[model samples]
Target: MSSPEHKQKIWKMIKDIKVGMLVTLDNGVPRARPMHLVQDEYDGTLWFFTRRSAEKVFETAGDQDVCLSFSDQEEGVYVSLSGKADLTDDRELIEKYWNPFIAAWFHDGKDDPDVALLEIKVQMGEHWKAKESKTFQLYEIAKANVKKDATPNLGENEKFGG
Candidate 1:
């Protein structure tokens, strides 16, 4: 279990950057695809809309362990999350996350048989955030290069959860 504060911190980092690359093992090979994160709050779980017949769904059914990678280059923030994924057709959950954008895929809307929820119960996550401006970061790198014995201060790196 993760603390509420930790979940909030993760949510704040990812809220603006809503898309993530979800990776799952396929026949012992890593397969990855972009997924749009659907959520209103963070509770140690991430949700995405997926078709019931989607390859990711099938992959998760075989191996629940998954990884999600999120990045915002402009903000200099990157996060990697590991979790267990499962597919569900629960009506309430489907309705809760349904949006007009999702209709583009599920033409039949929330009631569509193909519409399903991909729930990821996050177990661990690591985030790297750069607090300094890019210009300053560049200067730091140059200074480090001149010194030869120093390393650039890029930012803070934190690991949370199990």
Candidate 2:
């Protein structure tokens, strides 16, 4: 079982880093590409816009298992999400998450025949977020290096599930 607070924290980090690498298995090899996360709410699911003819759609069709990796370097936050990706032609969802940025990709707009949605039902996730400033982190690392018996305090690492 997971706590609501953990879920909220994970969602907050994900929202903060809107773009993530979506990884899918292509012929038993991992293939990844940067994708924009469009969903506003985190309810054990994430959404992305793609074209029907996209290679990712075909890849997911073969193997639903996928991973989404997010990183906010300035904030020192990194997250990995494991889930199953499904491709859909849901017009309702397309319209709900539509924006001008997305319009640039879909030249024909939401009604474009190629418009498609990639939905990932997240099953588990892990995140590492720095609890201290970079300078402090460097100081801790230096201290640890000098004191071989000490362990460097870096950040919070948590794993949660839906």
- TM-score of every candidate: 0.96, 0.94
Q: How would you encode candidate 1's per-residue C-alpha lDDT over 1-162 as one tens digit per residue?
A: 678988998999998999999999998899999999889899999999999999899899999999999999999999999999989999998888888888888887789788899999999989999989999899989999999999999999999877
Runs of candidate 2 exceeding 4 Å displacement: 1-3
Hey, what RMSD does candidate 1 come out at? 1.0
lDDT of 2 by residue, 1-162 (tens): 246676677789989789999999889999999999887878778899999999999999999999999999899999999999998888889889999889998888899889999999888889999999999899999999999999899999988775
Query: With candidate 1 superimposed using the best TM-score fit, by how many Å does residue 149's alpha carbon deviate from the native?
Result: 1.9
Model 1 stretches astray by more than 4 angstroms: none
